[model samples]
Structure formats: C-alpha cells, structure tokens
Target: AMFESNMLETKQREIVINDIDPDALEKLILYAYEGRLEIHQDNVTNVLRAAHLFNISEIVDSCCKYIEKQ
Candidate 1:
C-alpha cells in the first residue's frame, strides 16, 4: 500500500460524497473517530445506510437494534 509505505503519495486525497446527507456523513465520521455513535429516530436510516455502504458492521448492528426496540 503506497499510503502505508509513505511512498509516492500526496498529502491530501479527494473524496466525492453524494446522495448521503452532509449531517449524516459528519455524524458517521464522528462515530469513526470517537468509536461511538448516537443513533436516533431522525438519523437512524441514513446512518444505517452509510454504515452498510462503508462495511461498518458495528454501526449497522447498532442501528438495527435501535430500530428493533422502537
């Protein structure tokens, strides 16, 4: 991995995010950084979708459990 080897890599990378809401993306990043996420009725579906796309099983499961309890 060039990024892991620190070879021939730029300092910045460009990522294009579409379809997902900005607020939901922000919350997902926050969850990734802090290892915790607070899922609520309003954002659950969006967050869950993001989690599934990103292959984040923990968040996906959390969202499912939250939905089940609702």
Candidate 2:
C-alpha cells in the first residue's frame, strides 16, 4: 500500500521506518529474499519484535523457538 500510494510517485521515493533497529531491519530484508536468518542472543529480541510488527509469522515463530531453547 505504501509503495502503491503517492509516496513512491514523489521524487524522493523513500519510505522511512521509524523506531526499528537498523540491524533487525536488515535481517528482515535478507530473510524476505533468502527464506532464512540467524536468531542469536544479541538480535533475537529485536528481530522478534520487528517480525511481529511486520506480521511475518515465519520469522516470529523462528524467533520464539530460538528464545525457548535459550
């Protein structure tokens, strides 16, 4: 919706995501294309939060499993 809107038609064509960790965002983007990502002690929490916010169930489930094992 965001991309289909006038936001993309503008000259800037930039979508700003606020209040998300840069590293978590990068991991989510990679996971979208690769179908996999690393969930570690350092990033699991942030990644899980980001995944939940984006409604990415796969990542959220994986993060939950990783957390449970810790």
Model 2 Cα lDDT, one tens digit per residue, 1-70: 5556676545465668887898999999999989779779999999999999999999999999999999
Q: Ten consecutive residues with minimal summed lDDT in candidate 2? A: 6-15
Evaluate all candidate structures by whole-model CA lDDT and list the values in order: 0.83, 0.89
Prediction 2 TM-score vs. true: 0.85
Best by lDDT: 2
Put down candidate 1 lDDT per residue, 6-69, tens digits, no spaces. 5545344854667887777887899979987978999999999988887889889999999999
lDDT of candidate 2 at residue 55, scale 0 to 100: 96
Q: Candidate 2: misplaced stretches above 4 Å? A: 6-11
Q: Model 1: clashing residue pairs?
A: none
Q: Where is model 1 more than 4 Å wrong at Cα?
A: 1-12
